[model samples]
Target: MHVFLIAALSADGFIAKTVDQISTRWTSKEDAAFFAQKTKEAGVVVMGRTTFETIGRPLPDRKTFVYTTRELLGFPPELVEATQLPPAELLAKLEAEGYTQVAICGGSQVYTKWMQSGLIDKIYLTIEPVFFGTGIRLFTEEITNTIRLKERHLLSDQTTVLEYEVLR
Candidate 1:
């Protein structure tokens, strides 16, 4: 299955101002539309518990698999499922369920874990105009890898989307 990490970052390289901050508040509408379109095409999105809680609901027309040890309340199992499965195992399970691709929608730890697994095929980043100065980063820990740029799009006058192929 194709697994890609997608996120919108501030020009300073922060994903959000804080753990509970909603991305829509800082990211452009064009970026929001881009995220919806891509993840919808992927048919499934995987994120951490903090990211899931920040959104407060499962994305429409997609199966959301959240990485969490405890149950997430007030959501159907089909629409939103909590799991502890590692990246590869989860992707394999999703593939068996007929999903050809998966989106690693994030919050630090989740992104780090998937990248560390070396299962990420690509990365899509929307860089917005503003800077948070310091906040939650895309990955909580250090990461070193080479990725060649595959595509770029101007989401707006100030926002740009960069797509890169992982060079493992």
Candidate 2:
């Protein structure tokens, strides 16, 4: 399976102003539409607990896997599942279930975890024309990797999507 991390960030590199801040609040509509299109095409998404909570529901048309130990109560069995497997194991399970591509739609914690796991093959980041001087980062912990630029998509006049191959 091809696993990639996806996130939208402020121009200064923060993902959100606070833990509970919904992405749609700051991200452009074009970014939202782009997100929906890609994740829908992937058919599966994985995210941290906080990210799932902020969204408050399983994303329609895609199975959501929350990477946490907390029992995911109140979510439909078919739409959501809780997982604590390491990045490779989780990817294995999803691939076994017939998903070709997996999107890591995350909060900082999850982003760091997957990046450190060294399994992410690509990263898709939408940079919006906004600045939050201080906020949650794209990754909470220190990580180093060489990513080669693969594509640059101009979603709008002010919003751009950068795609990179996460070279191992």
Candidate 3:
């Protein structure tokens, strides 16, 4: 499976102020539009439990897999599929089902876990023009690989989108 990650972060590399933070609240409109477009094009969307709860609902017309060790309540199984499988198993399952692309949205832990497992293929990051002095970072675990820049786009409102291919 080709796994790509999409996130909007502050100049200081913070994705959210807290685990329950609503990302759209601080992310720019341009980034929001880009995220929407990317997610819609993805064959599968995967996120952690906290990220799924923060999003509040399943995305329409696509299968969303929320990876959590424990079961989640308040949402029907049809709307979202909760899985405890590790990244490798999850990717294998998706591959068996014929999925070509996977979007790894995050809550820091999930992002780091997948990267540590070398599952991420590309990264699409929107650097908002603001700074959160202190907050949750994009990745807490250390990733020591280089990524080749694929594209850069200057969005309206001074937002910049950077796409990179992770060199494995």
Candidate 2 residue lDDT tens string, 1-168: 788899998999999999999999999999999999999999999999999999999999999999888898999989999999988898888889999999999999999999999999999999999999999999878889899999999999999999999998
Worst-scoring 10-residue span by lDDT in model 3: 70-79
lDDT of 1 by residue, 1-168 (tens): 899999999999999998899899988889999999999999999999998999999999999999998878999889999999988889889989999999999989999999888899999999999989989888877787778999998888888999999998
lDDT of 3 by residue, 85-113 (tens): 88999999889988888899987988888
User: Candidate 1 at 66: error in angstroms?
Assistant: 0.6
Better of 1 and 3 by lDDT: 1
Deviation (Å) of 4 in candidate 2: 1.0
Compared with the true structure, all predictions reach lDDT values of 0.92, 0.93, 0.86
TM-score for each candidate, following the candidate numbering: 0.98, 0.98, 0.94
TM-score of 1: 0.98
Candidate 2 error regions (>4 Å): none
What is the Å distance of residue 97 in model 3 from its true position?
1.8
